[model samples]
Target chain A: MTTSSIASPDVDAEHEQNKTPVSFLGPFCTYSHQATLLAFPDTSKWVLEPTSTIKEVFDRVQSGAAPYGVVPFENSTHGVVTFTLDGLADRAGEYPDICVCGEIYLDVHHFLLGRRPPSSSPESEQRSSGRGGEENPKGVPLASLSHIRRVYSHPQAFGQTARFQAKYLQPLGIEFIDVSSTSRAAQLAAADPKGESAAIASELAGREAGLDVLARWVEDREDNTTRFFVIRRKETTEGGYPPPEEEGKRYKSLVSFTVPHRQPGALANVLDCFRRRELNLTSINSLPSLVAPFQYLFFVEFEGGREDDHEGRISGVLEDLEKVAERWRWLGSWRRKR
Target chain B: MTTSSIASPDVDAEHEQNKTPVSFLGPFCTYSHQATLLAFPDTSKWVLEPTSTIKEVFDRVQSGAAPYGVVPFENSTHGVVTFTLDGLADRAGEYPDICVCGEIYLDVHHFLLGRRPPSSSPESEQRSSGRGGEENPKGVPLASLSHIRRVYSHPQAFGQTARFQAKYLQPLGIEFIDVSSTSRAAQLAAADPKGESAAIASELAGREAGLDVLARWVEDREDNTTRFFVIRRKETTEGGYPPPEEEGKRYKSLVSFTVPHRQPGALANVLDCFRRRELNLTSINSLPSLVAPFQYLFFVEFEGGREDDHEGRISGVLEDLEKVAERWRWLGSWRRKR
Candidate 1:
């Protein structure tokens, strides 16, 4: 694996040769959109299509509007985003032609933005605003969780607010609001009364919206990161592993399956198959099987490629899984540009 | 081993027996407070103080103000609430006697609320209160995701809002706000301009707050249940597991451990010990370790009472775990109510 960043022209040429346009959910500034750009900066020409759901990204790709799509797989703060999981499981058939070609790791930064100094920190900005109080009117202290009346942020930011709420807001009476994106949240806070509204967004968004940073690093954990999947409607190359046919490449595969409900040890049984075959499971996510109550669909990514060393074993496992699963899909296997 | 509700009297007796009041996070309406009451209904007689943070709860217990506390452990939709995890992991020494006794499950229901009638249902009591020709005449159509300028909910509710936002609001350019609880969200939404703001909260809360239900079951999945843990400053009951001493009773142990980062087989190694010992693993949750980056803390619930199990085998497994774990805590071994 090369550590050096792959140049955009080279990645564009590769995507052009593959005849695929990567699709992802975005209006150009959302986190997932940014991740897609980061992962495939030079993939021919990129299209920015607004989607109401992550599945829409996949749907557009399956419909051939684009040959590939990008969706958030998981976050360090929140677990798997179920929309991505259910979309893959529901459209398993369409996705078999699509594989997780690569993954992009991006750190999520949450900020508190407002037009005026928050009640918690009244002084520093008051000096600039020319409002002088007898006592130093400190800018509203972001540390005072009680001072926050309403919190605004993207759903992702909302997820990150879990710890802060549990630790601070839940006790204090602060309220949280969800926004389309951190940027939008910042925009709302800027437009609203700064005293009563605060946005949990990105520093860039705060600056862009002319909002001051009231607090930084509001996520429960400091190491907030999100993982994005680069998905393409292509079968695993001749040999299952992400083909190294081109330089600057890394490969990953995405697979989905539904397991029987109320049957004890169903998960264990499937896991046993992997254990018996000595296959390594990288990550496993389960979403409610939308078709019925109690049923679950699992999306699993593992270390080996479907067409490579463990191909036969995976096929055998799939055969066994078929008996228990109502639906299954092999999304794709593709190499990522580093 | 008795499946009996801990009514007020029993709770009183337990408080007398334990000599500590029970403190939780609530104003008697929040789910956590409700869960606390359900877990120990007589808590009112036993200093049922309400505090804001799990840390505060732990502190009250540690300082001898409260003998026990209840906090949310995890939600089926969102993973573990990290504050509770960190409070437990970071202050293990202060809470040495604290152990998980049992679990309570709560289902999450999100509802949209407003002050006006449904726009489509004119001639009905549900009349749009706002200006006509706009998308939302009764305020904005609560269903029009874009018209929603603000969203409010508990942090946990915020966590669950990811799928909702990704599906409805993100593309529509709506924003979400976080409150301390669903009830609070309802309260704020009811008081806000009907068309401009909506909340993701419980139907009951909306009704209590005199708001109309705009939407229900907004969560991505229906089985959105949250599990809470009962913690007390008491050691495991003697002879609480196995054989005649505790016949007809089942026992479960909760344990927390940190696995070495990047170790492929570290988790498998721990599970292998139980596999070899023929111990059944019931439930397992893995969350990012609060103390370190790139590390994981696993909360595992398994069969058997620690005291009744073979001491040598338990010790041996612990010894082996120490090699792979940076820190580990045997949370508790409790006999389950039959």
Candidate 2:
């Protein structure tokens, strides 16, 4: 937001000298990076920083190193990113000020990315020369899929493209290489001297790495997407949580809690609170409580924002949870992106 | 069960000539292979066969190519294995007879595996000759982790050992090579001639590959365990499904279903059926329905099995589900393995 320098003295004064920073989990060309860019498009107004891990993304915002941070929360194909959920739950008390302010829903696309064989290369020479239907952004004909020996991508990427991998690569006994990120995979694939290696990564990453897209839309499902949380440190004051930036936008609230494992119907009771209010729970996920084997820390998202709690329904659910749950936190509401 | 060939003329006759085939997901040394061995300890009575993928494991069992198949159902750390879940849900119609008969819980452990530096190598000479605190199975000291330029592993292995990786390997900016399986990672690590590569795999895999265990139990959590399902084709007769071989045991039932997305409390109502009966839900997970964007297919595990439904509680729940859910499948019960 372009706040008036005269009206906003404290916040604008710091940003007048240096740009406002936004942190994301990245090497570069990763989905988190893309989400960050999408969240803050004004490069002149914002400085984008990439952190090594999801923890660092939270830490940056928590430590006030950055005002905003973006991290992947879930994917349509791969259900949840536990690290992100766990970080949010664990730091609920100590980092109470940091909360998700918005969300980014990105349509994820994985491509078979690799270096194109040079014209003089034998693999190119051995091609059937029948590149009729295929065309890539680089305008170079892709080498035959048979020429590729190994594939590289993050584990989630490998999982997302299971159907494609089984159909095209399994019979050939091609080795699948997993990396930390899709961008890293692209970088590794590009470093292959023989052009025999491929990466399942974003089209942007492949182009940046100077790799060719061997195959497009390689994910198991066409509707593959990742949801990202745009977290910012709320200006907590004696007034409590700040008012919503957009008053009328429909929002989704995320709350994390834990219940005693020995108690039967405890989780169901907590859920029943939402059901009774017709809150419309969108997602429910759990991570190990870490204290015991069967214990879990649960996260659930519902349709209404704190501001939208006109009937005091969200507060009522929290009140019900007080009795059913051991610990809980209202991890701020965000406008729905999808 | 060792049935006399003379008593059982039909089933035991073919098995007498040839051992029953037990299929698993493997390249050897995989957790699935280990589980298969655990499930069928009588080696003479069973022939263990390794399949390339989980789908193949199901295919073999459905085709009767293998009488029993062992597939990983879930992990404490990673939650559900969606591929395994989806396979069960989809095959409910065509492979109605196949159902989960048993479960195996394997404690998962990851090791930092690599080749030791040769005694004559320069790196070994530079070791200060002060190897005291550490010793490996091969009786050779591990070269410093600094010597490892790249680490190979399945993505889940990388995820499981993220704490260790972040503390040590991340600082070195060591490249991660992801493979199809942990066993494959061990194979790749062992092939490193310079001993400059490491793999995060099982101790069995590392030892079988002739690699030294640099570190033991590198998994981030102590309670890391994978749950496997022993699936077998039921012998359906004109009368009905047969009775359980063992009568009174604590059993867990897995059921798969989908509720209409348009309905607000569709999922909560389905869960209410179990809650009202005090049937504790051990786990709940969702996967994209593939039909549309927001639609999901859900899998839930509860405390009771078919025969344990003495009061017809489970059947009553199923009857209730038929009204709430679009489709449902009672995917058999298995004795719980902690």
- i-RMSD of all predictions: 4.9, 2.5
Model 2 chain A poorest ten-residue lDDT run? A1-10
Model 2, B150-218: lDDT tens digits are 888876677677778877788888877667789888889989888889989887788677787677778
Candidate 1 lDDT over A1-338, as tens digits, reads 11122212334344455443567765445677667767555433453445645767877766767656789977766655656664566532444455566677788767666644344444444211222245332222344445557767766676566555556555666655655566667777778753567777765566556666555566766678888886665652322223345554334456677655544445555555556655555566555454553245666565555546334766675676666555567766544432
Each prediction's TM-score versus the true structure:
0.67, 0.81
> In angstroms, how far off is B178's CA in candidate 1?
6.0
* TM-score for the A-chain in each candidate structure: 0.74, 0.84
Any runs in candidate 2 off by more than 4 Å, and if so which?
Answer: A1-17, A89-98, A115-144, A171-173, A233-248, B1-17, B89-98, B115-144, B166-177, B234-248
**Ten contiguous residues with the weakest lDDT in model 1 chain A:** A1-10
